[model samples]
Target: MRLPLTSRRSHHRSVCVLLSALLCSGLACAQASYRIATEGTYRPWSFKDAQGALQGWDVDIANALCERMKARCEILAQDWDGIIPGLMARKYDMIVASMAITEQRRQRVDFSDKYKDTISRFVAQKGTRQDVSPSALKGKTIGVQRGSIQANYLSQNYKNSDLKFYDTPQAAELDLVAGRVEYILGNMVTYYVGFMKTAESANFAFVGPDLKGGLLGDGNGIAVRKGDVELLSKINAALAAIRADGTYDRITAKYFPFKLM
Candidate 1:
């Protein structure tokens, strides 16, 4: 039974439409399931609580963004050293750890808009000379988080200093209190939360100039693989929605009553 040429063409068109619909559905499903990675040790940014549940400003923000995007998010914990490499290997869809957006890292991955701004400060025993500069710290030991902007800054500016890197900022703070390092370089917020809140830190004060922008980045932002423009756009839109609806303000206020954003 030879069908007419028109009939055959119509059948082919129908099949093509069905295949297109299926392909689109598959892509949507893939996009809906996003895997986010975070360093589960940086307090107030992303970390696991005593109960082993991840909680922090970044975790809250990530959850809100996921809700707005109507996506199923899976937050995974990865070591700080392997974070960028894991993303490059496609181990996760994005990184929400307190990642500073610098030009050097931009060459490897893309970053979303700055969600929080922070200034770097040097913490030393109270009454210590406030005039100490990065150069003044040369030949002395300084404590900082491994793979942090503070470490990078010291490596570039004060190469002569013996930089001690710790897995967590709390570790560095402990070493600082113990006098293992002459000074500690870290973000202002974390330093305030950890050190200023403690009675012992009353003798410790932040010295030197406030560090911001430039190599340290305007603030902390989420990182995504290069060429993942679609995911990046969606995440950015979600962030904007949260900010506009006052969700961001509420969250920020809960952690920092003063001006931190």
Candidate 2:
């Protein structure tokens, strides 16, 4: 028989609170396996295959990190917007998505040292001929992934442009190709290797120069709850080990042509 709503809520809280308490108590929680999160919609970074299995660089890196840490980990697919909130609620122990390390995010969570450093770029139809300046994009719709650094950059620097937000970067690119948006801003590697290289993107080209720093922050890092120093340390150590031992290179070669770490 099902329990009452209040009873269910109380039970959920009790279990989460207990887990939170253990997680904060030095390495008590680390003794157990970790629940890692990744946005499975992002290709090359993390995405689900036709059979619904999560595959890509982020998943591989997460597995490598778990192996180096000598810990078992289960990678769960989480929506990009709720990824951090899910971590805060203890739904997952850590986030291994391509989440950039920014000051705004650091207030809510602690991040492991950066694992990948890359820049952002704008993509538009070939021969479209428009710069990223506000005047050039004035009434044009610029598609971007919601809650991403590129979205923030567009909102702040191109105030006159029309912003279209999508839950995933691929959605925005789809819209761009469908003639729904004049341009889309996102990770350089994502556009270059993930999208532009594909046959569907034959008509698209990178516009403007590479964007970095100032809001984009310092690349991607693993995010853990604040004050979860033990877990953070372990993740950082594992990342360093993988990079030093050539495991990172092997993973990188499978996804990207050049080094990302």
Candidate 3:
């Protein structure tokens, strides 16, 4: 049954009040609960399984951190582009969507210490000889996820390449597989686990050395809104606790063949 309009407004206010006490307050606040937001489409990090249940390294790590903090936690799916705005609007408490910790992003929101470090690499169809250098890849089409550090990297390093930006990395992968683009730039671990492990990717392989530094950022971390110092500190501590107790290792093993932390 639907509630009266007044009742609905009251409920909304109550939710915000509760969240403010916990999310925007000092760690000593009484409310011990929070909601974590994820893109829920990044494979091996935070994606739904065949059963439609959310399952991935990021989900597990968020859950583990919540446990260590003795807090009530809910992992919610959100669009990648709006994740940060949602956090700022109090729609969620934190972001655990394999977002990199970068200086540009830091201006908008704070981030916890890195939970995993992955390198950006180039992938292309096998038997294609190409160099990632600007002059060599000139006129060659490249696919990259919009708003990602990889896109920034491509812009800075390969200005001569024709760049196609997709909202999701998966879209870029689809374009790469369909021969729409000669190359794709993204995290090495993501491509390996999400595509390269599959039979369809048999013909595709790494085309150049892994790219790092300058624009790619440090690594993936839990993101919270700026000025939310108390909540951020607690999350950082919880992240450390999970790693110390081996929970982080277990989650990484489930999705990746190599260590990310």
Q: Please report the candidate that would top lDDT against the real structure.
A: 2
Candidate 1: 10-residue stretch with minimal lDDT: 23-32
List where candidate 3 sits over 4 angstroms from the true fold.
1-31
| Tens-digit lDDT string for candidate 3 (87-181) | 99999999989898888899999999888886988899998775677787999999998878898888888888899999988899889989999
Model 1, runs deviating above 4 Å: 1-26, 29-31
Task: Please give the distance, in angstroms, between residue 197's alpha carbon in candidate 2 and its true position after superposition.
Answer: 1.9
Better of 1 and 2 by TM-score: 1
List candidate 2 stretches off by more than 4 Å: 1-31
Model 2 root-mean-square deviation: 11.6
Encode model 2's per-residue lDDT on 81-175: one tens digit a residue.
Answer: 89999999999999999899888899999999999996998899898775677788899999999988788878888888889999999899899
In model 2, the clashing pairs are none
User: What order do candidates take by TM-score, descending?
Assistant: 1, 2, 3
Model 2 has an lDDT value of 0.91
